[model samples]
Target chain A: MYKIFLTFILSILLLPYSSTFAVEVDMLIPPSDFQAFDTPNDDGKSVTLRWPSSPSESTEAEYVVYASLRKNGPFTTEVLRINSKTMYEEGSDSNFHYVEIKPGKFFNKDSDVTGGRSSYFFRLVMMSNSENVTVNEIASATPKGNWFNWKKLNNFIILIAFSTLVLWFIEHAKKNPNLYLRKISGLDAIDDALGRATEMGKPVLYVHGLNGMGSISTIAAVNILGRIAIRVAEYDTTLKVSNIDPIVLSVSQEVVKESYLEAGRPDAYVEDNVFMAASEQFPYVAAVSGIMIREKTAANFFMGYFYAESLILAETGASTGAIQIAATDSYTQLPFFITTCDYTLIGEELYAASAYLSREPLLLGSLRAQDIAKGIIITALVVGAALATIGIGFISFIFKAS
Target chain B: MNFFKRTIPLIIAFIMGIMMAFQYYVPHEASQSLLKVVTRWGITIAGFAVFIGAYSLFHLHWNKIKRKVPGWGYSTFVFFGAGITIIFGLYNGGEFFLHDKQEGTMFDWMYFNVQVPAGATMFSILAFFMASAAYRTFRARTSEATILLIAAVIVMLGRVPVGALIWEFLPPIADWIMSVPNMAAKRGILIGVSIGAIATSLRIIFGIERAYLGGGD
Candidate 1:
């Protein structure tokens, strides 16, 4: 009796820490038709989906559907809350449950299918009462694919036009062999910011964004960091390159150290200057914000991908009156940076800045090619608009004519 | 030597880039196998790089602790956190439930419960700061500022129940502002941004941008 009492007390104490018993329930929606609608509405392929409603469906809760591109994917994750259209009748035995699968945007003009032409694994899960749990999943579903992306006609034309412009520019560059100059305000400010730091006898801080080395934007940031490090080495001024991503941090350390070595200032390279502040996002932001305030960093160089923290960093820099030079490929935060920073590189301009500053032949040539692509795109747009106004099928004619 | 240094990575990049590009259009089993091999090698190389990062981290913090730096105590905390997690992870070798699950381990506990919450706390604090900053910085200083301030106010008001009660037209106004004017501006910006990205990619692919390859004289 004493042993039993002790066991009961121990179990009660462990109850909160112990994992909750997961209730498994299977939820099904009715059979739906997957149709192809290129020429017209036609029967094509089929897909079946089964989801488990919440462990308790009759209770006050709803479910959302998620589909992944593959068996294990960067899942087709949507944050939209969708309620269960069909619920099990507690007292009735019904095998056939009618489900109204809403027409997704991927479908062209009231087509009864979702977008993309890949096998997707779908799961139905509930999100309510501070608990999110997956209820049921269909192992596979293939959305019908139509070859012609009619909806993306605008994008297709733009691509073709841009490719043409880029090719044209490449050819023009090859023939002329002349240096093409493009304005980059951020590149111009690099020297000014560095000079300010040099005069003030204060350090410059460089953040290589919040992405891993695998990201293209991080590569751009690292490239820019190398340039700044070289300048720092030459000036014999301090340059602290803080990184959030571990892999990028390693690469950045190498890049900065190499830059210093090349600048004939191998002794000036401090290991602590190139530090990795955690892999997490906002923590890195806090660390950076703290560093900016603590160091009284005269210049803040922000280059790469940034999200909500972009403005926070920029605003803090503004507060400090640092010559903030920010370049990012992110469109969302570009406006904020522009409003706050002294020099802001918009989108591809970040990439262009590196090329303009470095002027490597490959970079120049590619820039030239890309320009040609853009010109071609503009020409196509002009031609397409004109043809539409005149009621002629100019784009189709061009495709067929080619 | 110059030829080798410049052309080698460029050649490799081009070949890899082109191969990957073509593989997307091709539907061959051999191509698929090649892609799989490339992906596997990429992942392996990435894993090795991660190992290098871990080593660097160890070296940096170990030196700090040895030198008795101000934050040396934190270094000890990190070492213990990392060591205990690794020790427990390898000891049970998946036999124990605690060791079996990745999240069940101590590292995950520190990561999810402690580190993640600390990070989230920092992130959520931004919401309050944004409101304050918006009010201060977005005062009608100019035409653009006035327009921005008005739009922001409308959007903020439209998102709440009180705004709908005060003005029924506010919701539709907010929707129109977001979907039409905002969307148009966003689309324009997106297109412009994509153009820039493509240009940059072409430069890297062709080997014009060697600054990323680590700049030297």
Candidate 2:
């Protein structure tokens, strides 16, 4: 009984040295400058383990990183198993081999990773031919989450400066609401189109192209729609609005309804006038094409973002002898619209539609702010090109984000 | 009444606008989680929006059918198409097809065999339309159009093998045009669009633009 008790005590005492003693051959040496530290700029789920490549390591040798919650308890989990060849392939320098330790699906209380709060013990074992040849001392690190991404600081600064410019312009415009904006001919001809629709005793068809509610062009289209709705209501001319998105359809209904109310012609507002044509791309084009042919709309307004369907819609409208005006920010689809429609709003012109139509000082102010921002961007580009030509690449580098 | 109709919505827009705008800068796990949650919420709302789309579609067609409009016959096809697609989807292509597991549901077969071909046909028609548009565009009616015509020719040639046979230098010139002048023009427009988008977003965020809320203000 005494011998058994002594054996138990010795076993408890030598538990730490068992890993060292269990090595069959001391052919390997522990890597120098071993470290375990929190991985920077990431969620607290991982820590980076680093060690300088050891001279004794060969292509055949394997690196085994054993992890445990306790400092000296059993390191049951083999967190990593990689050969020295792969570690060397990552970098030719004898500097460091890095392994980011993150827990997988089966991790539990023993791993003790409470999102950077837990400090887990990690020890390395160098093995060859399935035998432990060397062992490294345990080190601990806590994986942490950072509050801010320093990389996006440049973008943040630009956004802040631009916003400040907009607000300043908007404030200035309130006092002096006559912000000079170039006349967009497409928007200018809207009244004539409406007048023609009324004269011809035919409906005015408005198609919001294939864009979601979140798109800037779509919002601009909606704003334009509101203005058109008011004019149509007052003129007592029928206006049909076709939609591809349900949200846009819902919003259009409300916008048209309110426009009718504002025009004091709530009775003339038809719920079915604004409806979802189709959700899919080709279906939407097909439906809108059918509307153009069947209604024989005197005037057609195709606005927002478009894809391949731009031509089909415009061509069908053109065939019906309607005066068509198309506006979109999609540069790729501009050629098609320009060819088929009577007038096309290109690039930034589409964005200026609402401001021009509403003639609201606040909206015009935003437009002016955008123009000023564009001037700044143009100057920056010029300077950047000059500097790059002269071998002063600092400006270009500053603009480049990681 | 004004508060509920206008002010409340503006307040909500303000909160959402500020949150999403600044969320781009935050790298924390909590910030990422918030973005994911908000994105999921948007998707969930879009799922419910399907019903709104159906309501408008059915209402439009039903009106046309009821009134016996000129194209009323076509309107009925929309119903039959939707009904057939749904029924085929629910049956799962007979679900075991005499106790043998079929490759896919009838929905998949219908999509591939019927919808895909139909979509492809519509897409194919764009080529003819493109040719027509190209014919109109390539006409050198003005000085600007002449320049456009020349540029378009170069790009078209550069994309094909025959251009190299015509002149070895032609390909390089075309490449230079695309890489430098074309890229510069595209970037210029993109910058303007981005700035416009940002300004519009700010206008909405600050409650200066109420057109989207149907001009309740």
Among these predictions, the greatest DockQ belongs to 2
lDDT of each: 0.68, 0.84
lDDT per residue, candidate 2, A192-295, as tens digits?
99999999999999999788887889998898898888999989999999999999999999999998988899999999999999999998888899888988
Per-prediction interface RMSD in Å: 4.7, 1.5
Alpha carbon RMSD to native, model 2: 9.6
| TM-score of each prediction | 0.68, 0.86
User: What value does the lDDT take at residue B34 in candidate 1?
Assistant: 80
lDDT of 1 by residue, A27-90 (tens): 3222232211222111223343433233244344555656554456444564235454354334
lDDT of 1 at A210: 76
Poorest 10 consecutive residues by lDDT, candidate 2 chain A: A103-112
Top-TM-score structure, candidate number: 2
